[model samples]
Structures are given as C-alpha cells and as structure tokens.
Target: MSEEEFRESGGRNTVFIGRQKPVMSYVLTTLTCLNNSPDVILKARGAAISLAVDVAQITIHRFAPGLRVADIKLGTEQLQSEEGGTRNVSSIEIRLTYPPEGQGEAAKA
Candidate 1:
C-alpha cells in the first residue's frame, strides 16, 4: 500500500524504506514499535529491498527483540520507465507483529 493509504488505516503502522540511509529507517522503525503499534509494515521497492530487510532486522533483533515477523508479501509491478517503456519493478512488504501482553518471546518461538 502507498504511504498515504497506510497512514489512513487508523491502527496500522507502516514505513516506506526508500533510498535514504539505513540508519534513518532504523530510527523510524524503532519509533513505530515504541509507539505500541501491534503490527508494522515495512514497504520497499526495487533496490531498496536490502535496506528494508536491514531495517527490519535491526528493529527486531536489536531494538525490539519481542517483535516477530508475521508475514511477507512480494510482487512486481509494471511501471512506465524514464525511457517511456514498460518495466517491471520488484516490491516487498514485511509485516512485523508484536506479541500480545503475557505472550512474549515464548509465543513467538
């Protein structure tokens, strides 16, 4: 989903990982988790996929060990290239879910 659409979903937390530095992505992910969002979706396209993965890892392992990956969806979209030709670009959605109270890491494992 687009950033605007994600934001419009009241209870949903979403982050778009673009070409910016990975550190910035990490910070945003951390903040989202700290905000008590039950689930967070990390979206990235094309070359930014690796950066998105890094952000998710750092957020889960380092920042929020209690969080776990709930699901992942991957696909490609056909877009008009700068050269005016159709091109297929890869996209990914990584969903992280925080366990409910009293569940903790045991439930995740």
Candidate 2:
C-alpha cells in the first residue's frame, strides 16, 4: 500500500481505542510512521499519559505478542503558540517500534 494508504489503514487499527474511550480521541491527534518500520510517533492533544497507554495496549493486540513497553518509547513537550501567552496544554509523544520486515532470515543474523 502507498504511504498514505498505510497510514490510513494503521489509523483504523487504533479506532477501537478512541470509540467510547473518554479523552482518547482528544489525546491522540495523529500517528506518523517513523524510520520506515511499525515505529510510530503518536502526537497527543494534551497531557494524556494514560491515554497513550491505552493506545499501546490496543496496538499490541492488533499487531502481536512481540509488542513490549520497552519497544514503545514515550515523551512529551509543549506546543508553540502564535501569541505571547503560553497555553496550558501539553503533548505526549509515543514511539512504538515493531519487528523488522523480514523475520526468519533476519532472526538468524
């Protein structure tokens, strides 16, 4: 699939997390592919540490048992505002890395 298609499909995988899950959709804004792997950087809307965890759990179930907390790196930062006044909002960035493309051969190396 094209990158856009892949991203869209990947986004669908997280739909369950947002549906009926309070503050989940608000917490996660976008999911960007990183380093050409399943590694994704989840851009958050506000300080949503728990929301991020919820997302990771959904991803693990969708992907496989190989998913681990260590593989999913988490971070946060404030967004830049146009005006002088700084907003109270914070963003959580999560880095989720899955296994490489090739499995059998790569495993030996």
Candidate 3:
C-alpha cells in the first residue's frame, strides 16, 4: 500500500521507530491517538526494540493513560548481511488501543 494510505487507515496506525529520537515516536503515537485512532502499532527491530518500548510507555502512561496495550508480537526475521551471510534479527510489534468512545477531551473529536 502507498505510504499515505498506510497512515490514514481507519483506527489503525503504524510507527516504525529506528534511529530517530524517542520523542519523535512519542509525538506520533500521541497524535495518532488524539486524531481518534483507536489502535496504534509501534514497530522496531534489533537494538531499536527498547526505543519502541519507551515510546509505548510514554504514550500510554504520560500522554494517554486511558489507552491500553492490546497485543504484542515478537519474532525473528532472516536477513541477508552485507557480507553475503544470513543473520537473524529480533523484532517486536506493540499494539495499543484506545477506548471506543475515546479518552477525556479526545472523545469529542
């Protein structure tokens, strides 16, 4: 799917956190929730998994306490290394869901 389409798809939104600062991911998650999105998925691989977790925590605890973790999926993917060897990298997907009626002031939107 196109990037734009992938972003504005119903109650679901996905944020891929990589080298960017954790604040960036936190802002995106908060905005997604404020925009009436019921679900937000945070994705990261390898070393970035901790960053993804921090984003999820900040979003749920600081920004949107009413939101809750709906699911978590973890796995490893095989990828080709630059040295022409195969490597397995761990990945994590964190799904957060807000209430159907929304949370606090966001409910009006």
Scored by TM-score, the top model is: 1
The digit string of per-residue lDDT tens for model 3 on 67-92 reads: 77889989887777889998887878
Estimate the TM-score of every prediction: 0.77, 0.41, 0.73
Error of 1 at 3 (Å): 10
lDDT of 2 by residue, 37-56 (tens): 45555534344456766776
Model 1 misses residue 81 by how many Å?
0.5
TM-score, predicted candidate 3 vs. hidden true structure: 0.73
- C-alpha lDDT of all candidate models, in order: 0.75, 0.46, 0.72
Backbone clashes in candidate 3 total 0
Model 1 agreement with the true structure over 3-104: per-residue lDDT tens digits: 455346434477777786656655575566558767888877899888888888888877778888889989887777779898887988888888778788
RMSD of each: 3.5, 9.0, 6.4
Instruction: State the lDDT at 32 in candidate 3.
Output: 68
Report how far off residue 50 is in candidate 3 (Å): 0.4
Ranking by TM-score: 1, 3, 2
